[model samples]
Target: MNPPYFSENSGCKSPDQSALIARHEVACNLTDISKCAAYLLKHSGRFCLCHRPERLCDIFEALRKYKLEPKRLRPVVQKDYQEPWLMLIEATKGGKPGLKIERQLIIKNQNNTYTDEFRSLYREFATF
Candidate 1:
């Protein structure tokens, strides 16, 4: 609605529960996001999201709490030798549980070079 009207607030804006809930954890957290997704998605509907790699447990915990079963997961790394900085996941609302974790996706090489696969993946957005 109205292009979402992105605004300014620290998620701690006074007298604005909606913005607070949306921007900060003042009234919301991963659980709230999962609940909102649960409300918006139909049974068996698929929901996917990308998040920081360190929050895997939080994401999984919240999704399960909302009856959303994680189906697939992929780690996003900048180099083959480094830890993942991002993670991608797909879940099904009210579906049976069976988490399928894919192999780590190495975005770059040891020398900070973009791998062919990574370049292909982001070809449209890459500059060189």
Candidate 2:
């Protein structure tokens, strides 16, 4: 569930409705998504999603509100020296209050080349 990362009141509107829905909270927000996940998942089941780093606090609050405790987080960074641009999160239904923050996943090297790990992860996919 790569849910919309933007707040409905925050961002500029897009003329493209599809793109707007995909990126903005036109249909559902994080709390709504988290609630659905909490309802659907069984005990110990994992709910995974990729989202913007800034929404981390909101995500945590939403997950907890619905009893989906955040268990793991993997920060995805463009370079090793930079702060995370994206976050890969895993929450477990009825899980305890423990969070395991994994190592940062660097997307590119200092020279602007894609990192080996990034390339390997998408090796089977077609690039535009």
Candidate 3:
């Protein structure tokens, strides 16, 4: 359920139509996504999505507004970057309020190779 990470008004528009639609809220915004998720998920079902770190607050607020309680968060960082650029989140429908923050998921090591964790995450696609 990864919705567009950028607000329609925030970023520079891309020349490519597909990229523009995929990257920005031209079609649907976070609140729209949250509401749809709530409607589709059964009680206690989990909804997972990845979004930018800067919008974490907004993400949480939107989720909660639709009665989806944030249950887990994992920050994704690249090696050598001090700040996290992405956030992976999981929320539960009609869940109790408690957020478990997991350790950072590093995408690359200092040697510029993918981290073991990252490799394992996409191992199924390696044969391609």
Task: Give me the candidate number with maximum TM-score.
Answer: 3
How close to the true structure is residue 9 of candidate 1, measured as C-alpha lDDT? 35
In model 1, pairs of residues that clash are none
Candidate 1's displacement at residue 29, Å, is 1.4
Full-model lDDT for every candidate: 0.77, 0.92, 0.92
Off by over 4 Å in 1: 1-27
Off by over 4 Å in 3: none
What is the Cα root-mean-square deviation between model 2 and the actual structure? 1.6
For candidate 2, write residues 24-81 as lDDT tens digits: 9989999899999998999999999999999999999999999999999999999999
- lDDT-based ranking: 3, 2, 1
Candidate 3 pairs with clashing backbones: none
- Compared with the true structure, the alpha-carbon lDDT of candidate 1 equals 0.77
**How many clashes would you count in candidate 2?**
0
Which ten contiguous residues of candidate 3 have the minimum total lDDT?
Answer: 119-128
